[model samples]
Target chain A: MTEADHETVRSGLETHLPRLWRYGLSLSRNPSVAEELVQATCLRALERQSQFRTGTNLRAWLFTILSSIWKNQLRAEKVRTGGGFADPETELVFDGAASMETNNLLRRVLSEVSELPEAQRQAVILVYVEEFTYREAAHILEVPIGTIMSRLSAARGKLAGLDSSATNARKTRADEVGKN
Target chain B: MVSAGMADHPRDEDLVAYLDGELALADRQALDQALSDSADLRARLEVLRGGDRPFRESFDLLLDAAPLERMRAALPDPTISASVISTTQTPPIPANDWRSLGIAAMLLLAIGIGFAVGFGTRSDMGDTALLAELDALEAELEEAEAAADAAPVATVKGWRQAVADYQVLFTTDSLTPDQGGDGALALASSQVGLNLDPATRAAAGLEFRRAQVLAFNSKPLVQLAYLGDDGVPVAFCIIASNKPEAGTQYEQRNGLGIVHWIIGGYGLMVIGDLPEERLNSIARDLRKSIQL
Candidate 1:
């Protein structure tokens, strides 16, 4: 059963790779670096798989691994390589069959989120985007829930600007279309 | 139509939490009523709302862009992955004893010396200046690590971190309501040999709940607990120490903001479920008003 549980964890890593890559992208702002982060996080997870509490939140635990590595060592190494401060929102944004003109509001909001200070961005992604409760985000981020609350509050103050503009843009579009 | 519970506008943080459906039911009802009555509050909420759907969608698009095939193929082989972890991972050696702390400091110094020599030999004779610079830098880091581990303020245990860990368990109900000018404060003060005075503290949204005597290494540790007006638990922890006076230093532990300093032969800390900025402001206020 213990062996089976460990297998469950390894297979489990597959299900979370996309989300992990996304989180890594959010942290590093570079898709390749984010992939590197995901790779390292997975390797670290497997190496210490025994320490995992079997039935608890695997996603949160995986996130804890990814963030700690970014905080402890990967960030310093990235800074030395000039990869630390690189802003690659263009690479990060969706570029599928959907036209860029159609994704204007979505892209603008995402760019605003990406441009927030690291702590606030992390809080915004974890709590608001990933839907982690403030408590869970606090635990994952190794901060008090109050810190998470304040980060979101500050983030809201910034994102609210984008929200209002987007709302007004919608209203203007509706006006042009003769909608009530 | 505003109820008395709507005494003031709920902060943007509360509104965001409410928007996420994460606000405690304790606060939800009051906020719900306030929204129903005040269009101004509703407008504020609207400005903060709508990010959830957009965020999820954008992120999903980002996820769709993920190189899923490449990532999966790149995962390390499970059969031999255990040995892949870095060797730098060190088990935490508890620095509970001065004798042990001394050893850690000496070992770090030896490592520093070894590092300097290893790198010094690699540099050419003309680069002697570079070697000296490297040695000096390593020595400084060694000294700092040694001092941090040996600091007398929290000699036997990570007392500040311990306090933070315990504090996370606090709730509004965890601390029974008390104005804190009572026998409890007096007892704590007597044990700690410092005034556990809430009288001097200006109540700025944090109401004093209780004072209690907690001990570490047989030294009296005073915990003065408060509940934020919005129901977060905040605490001030003090213990007798012979360390020289130091200015406020901020740190985070157990997900709480902490600001600590040494004053009047005592180590003082203010920690809470608060942002670092808020905690710092309160710490600054305490530094001025709470006379040693």
Candidate 2:
């Protein structure tokens, strides 16, 4: 690559690497796997640099690549393991001490989010965490906006239920503390 | 007047748009009014807005404790250099090893041919040639291994320099805009190291709508832009001191890319259509460069 091109790639890579890792982590729920995914994604991007449209959204393109790689890996693993899925409840167990005091409510909510079905989880993360627009998320997920809406709805309903339970539990605990 | 159940609590779809402020003015007004009147709805909105905070904070703490230098050492040396391509291209490998391997393979093939040719006349000659070919193959394998062990450090050095430059830029108050309007200009300057094409650079300038410098890790953190190549930026980057252990993360909403990373002693983000590779490369480079 020309010095300029190298600089461009380097700059772009530096700017986006963290987010890529995070996205990978969120999807794989493992740091090592996320790193591998990011590395593979970068190598692929480097190999197929010519395919990148100069003025296009580089992050989205990379994400598409990462998601495809991750999904493929998941599919391959599924084939190997006879299609068993992970338990959402187990994944939602958060360590209370690991969080800050101010974030107690937030942690409770996310744990509940983690319990959502895979589609709903993706929808919530994409909508809430990534903050993508409904149309844009639909494009990324290759589903209709309505599907995005419904998935989001399901996620929200589940999260709301979780939040209500958490709040109730907290209130009960507070009352007990007051009586003591 | 609508009854309690029918008072328009904002459907899930509308809530998403409302959170992103993508709703039309009329819708926004309605949603805002609803939020004012309904504590439960307001609380729910707050929960959604604050959903990722713990994750971000946890990731940030992890970054603080991570051994960044070790991570840098673990990274492969960049074989591709900047001074040579129209687009991204892999760096060419040294030819000496290939030449030796090729020569050995050819010698082995020739010896096999000789054995076949002499088999009727001299069996001893055939065995001798075969043995010599085997020795040559062994020698070739050793040479290949030795060559493989010696990686090009220049690429790693380049990556280091890029990271260092990013750290310096991120830490020094050189680019922080004094006012909000100047943030777009500041972002444009940050693009200098990125080496984007002029058109892409210009487009980035247009896409950057605002900038803010906030304190992170006792140093300034710059947050800028809402427009992205994806049509809107749902992402941002944070260039801060000391790399985050867990690294950066992204989520896309409404075609927006939200990116957050720590470079030097500051946090940075660039939310846009810019690809993840581009963002990652930049973040990694910055992380490697930041001093303390």
Candidate 3:
């Protein structure tokens, strides 16, 4: 590639690769799968170089590509296999719960967030985890701002319910310890 | 009115907009007011906003784990050589130009010596006086070159010497803005056309943005060019004078003219793009008003 072309590609990769990987991991929930997804996205980006416009936001473009790749290629297989699904009881069980109660509470909250529906999970990850604006997330996901808002709202509600339950559980454990 | 005051809690959409500072001012005001009244909504927003901390931290750790070499390996090689080659080519110098000049001068000198010797054989003339004069002139040129070279390389002392040599071509008055028609200003301006040091040009108050020093003549003279802040092409012919008194001489190819002087432990120069009259005015002012 020409120097200008090389700089364009290098900068695009640097800025968007991490976001692509994170999105991939969210979709696949497995490190190896995420790595494969990111690698595929990069190779596709290189192959389709002519489609990328100079000076536009490369991160947005890459995320859009990755999202499409997941929905079109990975989604059906993932749904069929349901292989990476977390077992709630096992995932929620914390070995250090008695000694590190606060950490246990936080871990339970994060696990509950992970258990949210895929749409809500993606919205939460985009807006809160990756710190994208709602408009940016909506654009990346090919949805309207209203859709993002509803998803985030649903995600927040689910998290609040989980938070309350964890708090109640902690209170009961505290009560038992006091009684002892 | 009671029902309006008891309107349902602002939706999660509004809370997200509020967090991002994107809500309309009035909406933001309404949400802030509602947040004060509704502990449940506040708690919900706080939890949603804070819940992503571990996720972000973990993602950042994963990104850090990807080796820098892996990222570098992913990038295509830059075709820098092709770009460089297409951008420019050095013009070829005429092979015999300097050689011809040297041969011509040597032949002329030999003819003159032969005539002097043949004439001395025929008549008792003051040939010795003529020969002595030529020898004395050669010695003076050598002295000038030696004096210019004595300054250390890449030091302020070296720059100072270059400035002094350049000043010798002009009259001795300290250059300033008010002295518009001074011979020193004219000579300094003319000498800047000669190749000189780039650093001395820069330090002497000629603004050369993104300049590279192309050539250094002996120790005190250099040539440089760069685009100026004004987007004009600026070329410098500079000289550094390292005498106890130091100064710089500068001339421009396109934009500005400069001549700096250093004498009696102080340094000074004239710099601008104006006509000779205006430059002289500036030079005279610089000479009379400025200490260095």
Query: For every model shown, what is its TM-score relative to the native structure?
Result: 0.49, 0.43, 0.42
B61-149 per-residue lDDT for model 3 (tens digits) = 33543334433433322221111111111123222122212222222222222212221122124435444543453465446436645
Q: Pick the candidate with the highest TM-score.
A: 1
Write one digit per residue (lDDT tens) for candidate 1, span A63-180: 9899987887567666654534453433344343134444776776677777777899899889767878888898888988878976876677666665545545543553554433
Which clashing pairs does model 1 show?
A: A143-B255, A144-B255
- Assess the local accuracy of residue B270 in candidate 3 as a C-alpha lDDT between 0 and 100: 47
Cα-based lDDT at residue B290, candidate 2: 34
Q: Rank the candidates by lDDT, best first.
A: 1, 3, 2
Top candidate (DockQ): 1
lDDT of candidate 1 over B48-149, digit per residue (tens): 784333776666667776889867755543432321221112223333322222222222222122111221123334234434643454465458547876
lDDT of 1 at A27: 85
Best by lDDT: 1
Candidate 2 per-residue C-alpha lDDT over B36-77 given as tens digits, one digit per residue, 9 for 90 to 100: 898977876766554333444433332332223322322223
lDDT string for model 3 (A93-131, tens) is 122222243454455554665577789878877877777
Off by over 4 Å in 3: A1-6, A81-110, A162-180, B1-9, B35-55, B64-292
Measured with C-alpha atoms, the lDDT of residue B95 in candidate 1 is: 39
